[model samples]
Target: MTDKSTSAPSSDSVSHRVADTSPESDRGEQPETIHEDRLWCDGGWTARVIKNEDDDGWAVEMIKDGEPEPALVGPWTMGRNKKDPKPLDVSAFNTLVKTASEVLRRHEQQLRAQLHKRVAVDAATGDGQWEITLDIVPDDDEPYALLTAIDAFGEQLAQVQVAASFKLSKASAASWVENGFRRPG
Candidate 1:
């Protein structure tokens, strides 16, 4: 969800921040280009339009700035934010806003997940540290398997994806890995 409200977040005053950081901001490198007039969550993110040198459409880039790479590229536009603005409406601004917002949101989500320790499984190999219990029932031609990796206390460590046509074993899998798995001939 993108909020295009006129109210800017206190932390995200684009004018002030842009002035503080970009050296070219003062020289008017970062001008207030108009478009759908789209602003999200008080400029937390905004899309900016750029002119496409090759085509008739416009190039829209989402400027995150908060992330390592501030400029995130998006699809080009046809008209200026869909409608006519009072002046030379650069629709890229709105596009930038939306794109930047999405990037930020995903970044924040990843951060939160990393910080919280919900599930932890040791992905180490072959000390007999974990046990894999696979029950293959081949009756009535209904072949199936319940693949589970469990700890010492019967607690599930991880669920492994098993194929319905189970034909591979650990030794074979290891050999395949070591051999770089070429065509069978």
Candidate 2:
């Protein structure tokens, strides 16, 4: 018996597949937009209603184009028959897009907060407050952090490259400022 999963999709099922529209494609034509009962692709996002492996219920996943993972996945409502998933509609798709976009935005904000930090330290000379900031570059080959000191006039006093593991705390910033903004050992 032929394996249904490995067999070529029938002509009727071809409509559900997204066409190749990448720069390397010979046609270089944009795929026809899809708006089916269980799938949608528009606004650079796709919402798909799928079977939930954890349970008999249904689930929906929203994927942004070019991203390998789904941005959002959650329980899906049941249809009137209670056996099939509720059909995807324009309103539902738009709402899913908004929620998935928000998820991505929040992730970016959290990452930024983790990689960037700031603190204010008083100079020993009592000149003014020094704004000290730490910006981390998370490169895979060579990770590092930049420690910067900015004077009250917003002029950069010094910047030094430090280990990515450098911890920027109040005491550390103060010690660095006391040491004349030298690279921390």
The lDDT of model 2 is 0.84
RMSD of each: 15.0, 5.4
- 174 in model 1: Cα distance from truth in Å? 29
Off by over 4 Å in 1: 1-46, 51-57, 65-68, 80-99, 119-185
Cα lDDT of model 2 by residue, 93-182, tens digit: 899999999999999999999999999999666997888999999999999999999989998989999999999998999999988888
Highest-TM-score candidate: 2
Q: Which TM-score value belongs to model 1?
A: 0.29
Instruction: For candidate 1, give the lDDT of residue 135.
Output: 43
TM-scores for all candidates: the values are 0.29, 0.83
TM-score of 2: 0.83
